[model samples]
Target: MSLHDPAQLMDERRRLEGLGLSVTRYGGAIGLIGLVLACLMGFIQENGMDRFFFVYLTNFIFFLSISLGALCFTGIQHVTRAGWSIVVRRLMELLAANVVLMAILFIPIIFGLHSLYHWTHAEAVAHDPILQHKAPYLNTAFFLFRAVIFFAVWIGLALFFLRKSTEQDESGDYKISIRLEKVSSWGLFLYAMTTTYASFDWLMSLDPHWYSTIYGVYFFAGSAVALFATLSALCIGLQKSGRLTRAITTEHYHDLGKFLFAFTIFWAYIAFSQYMLYWYANKPETTGWILRRQTAPMLWVSLSLIFCHFFLPFFGLLSRHIKRNKSLLFFWAIWMLVMHWVDIYWLVMPEYVHQYGEIGAAPFGLMDIFCLIGFGGLYAAGFAMWARGRSLIPMKDPRLAESLTFENA
Candidate 1:
């Protein structure tokens, strides 16, 4: 039963495998069905088929953000060799593994380029002098090429770190840890540049005419918030399953709560700063985008975000006691996740429906569910499989002992 004994860990792995098989079977089925329903609904709605392409593209990018953010978190922990996060790092690795699934999901985005992005229309691009000027860089051929490079780099780095960490667990090798640290240091820098540009290429290009220099940062901040929320929820769920009962304690939950609170504020700050600069400058192009969001249903959703995403969580999580309480933190984490989804919906839905006078829930349909389920089910299934035979903690980490005994000062 010694923590460091490889044999004891193997026994634990068998228990985990049994747990995973049952969870994956039930959870995967429900998730797949829900997603299929969303996709079907999308197909049924008027213009739903066309809009489905955009929705799918958006979901794919959102999933990519989660996967990449997980990769970033894992890299950061290695580079810093932070001890406090050892227990939760496995969750991040599992999430990062989903990057491969996201890459496959991106194919729809490529095929639907003409439907989703204005720049993809040759006739439209030819008439617009500005778009024409950017054509060399914005062309479909270049776009696909860039996407492949981005995913290849991301997948390679994620797998490299993950494999090294897992191998080190069995062999008790410190060199693997050191090697990963070196890789992660460089990986972090590359991630920053790639994610920013990827956001510009995928989301920002929806409105080719309107541009924001800070758009990438805006997306980056949101991604971080979403990732933290996701981690908190995942940890809480794992605890509920009776695993990690000893390893993930109130102290860990407390720190996770603090992270969630900090990122929630960061997301709001970045969002507000972006809006304020554009609004104050009064540039026609910049203000026009805000104007579209300010009217009708988008406006209400924007205001709801002010409360649900920030103000509610800000006040709710302010108490030290709240952060230390599992149930309370879980509730806040789930709430924040919902708000993040709404935030993304607000960001994307406007681009497609802005031409219409005001926004309305067009209809609930299949495409939405299909894309979400198709992607989400695969993500969950992969995460479960990844979790099956590994110590949830990095057992051989030089810092594992420190992490097991860690206390916040």
Candidate 2:
């Protein structure tokens, strides 16, 4: 169990066979019940279907961004030939692979397009010049096609990295690392472009007229924060459940906390950069999006993102002692995860409310909570499914030895 005994890592409890089975069963049940209840609430309430789709989209984007962030992080580690992360990379890979699950969840949003997006309406586009101008790119067919392409690329990259990484587990071949490095070099470029355009299609186009060149980066920053927080939380949870108790150490948690802290700042920077540009430009189309969020309720949500999302966490995570403390890191991890959802909700709900002419009304409701619980359960189920009968860490990764012996200077 000691770091000096690298050979003992091979004897670690790599598979989650016991705990994973229980999580999959209970998490799937909870997910299904939550989704069904949210559906019933949507039908029972007035204009509830509209609220359902927007709330669903908000939660959808929130979870999907986490997977997308995982994919990006996995690729970054591979391309950089990172050693400190081999102990944790498999967790990221599992999260990335759940993009396949996100693809399945996306079907509901397709059906809700008319409810969620203004540009999806043909008559409205015909009358509006801006929508007309953006029509070629925003039409239903093109939107779906782009989505398919995005998922295809993401799934392909996810499977390749995961398959090869797992293959290396058996073969213990260093060549597998070379192959992964080659793919990741170009894989990241594709990741950047697809995530950018996908965010544009899914989130930005909600407001057909508003545009920001940095919106994709904004999403990516938050996604990175989500991935690190989720990873930190997962590692802590796994250790608590008596899995990988020694293989993953305080050292790894410290590094995860540092990334969590770093990306928290990065997200705030991108958020402010986007906001500052809109404030400085004073452009009607872009400013309209910002102004809508400035109204009551949402204004409070916006303020929360400013303080809770950034300032509060910035100071809370400033100390090395805090990052190194497992208990403290777990708290910050959970905190960042909640803030990331608020950030996604802030990005999405304003447009949904603006469409209903209820700019003053806060869109927070039971349905949002239900949808979040639904997605959270399903996310847990999918991750557990991928994790079952598999090593919690990449047991045979070439750099795993380095990770096992890694220390912060």
Clashing pairs in 2: none
lDDT of 1 at 173: 87
Task: Write candidate 2's Cα lDDT for 199-271 as tens digits.
Answer: 9999999898989999999999999999999999999998888778888888888899999999999998999
lDDT of 1 by residue, 159-241 (tens): 88778888877787888878988998998998888888888888888888888888888887777777887888888887677
How far is each candidate from the true structure, as Cα RMSD in Å? 2.7, 1.1
Highest lDDT scorer: 2
In terms of lDDT, the poorest run of 10 residues in model 2 is 1-10
> By TM-score, how accurate is candidate 1?
0.92
Give me the displacement of residue 359 in model 1, in angstroms: 4.9
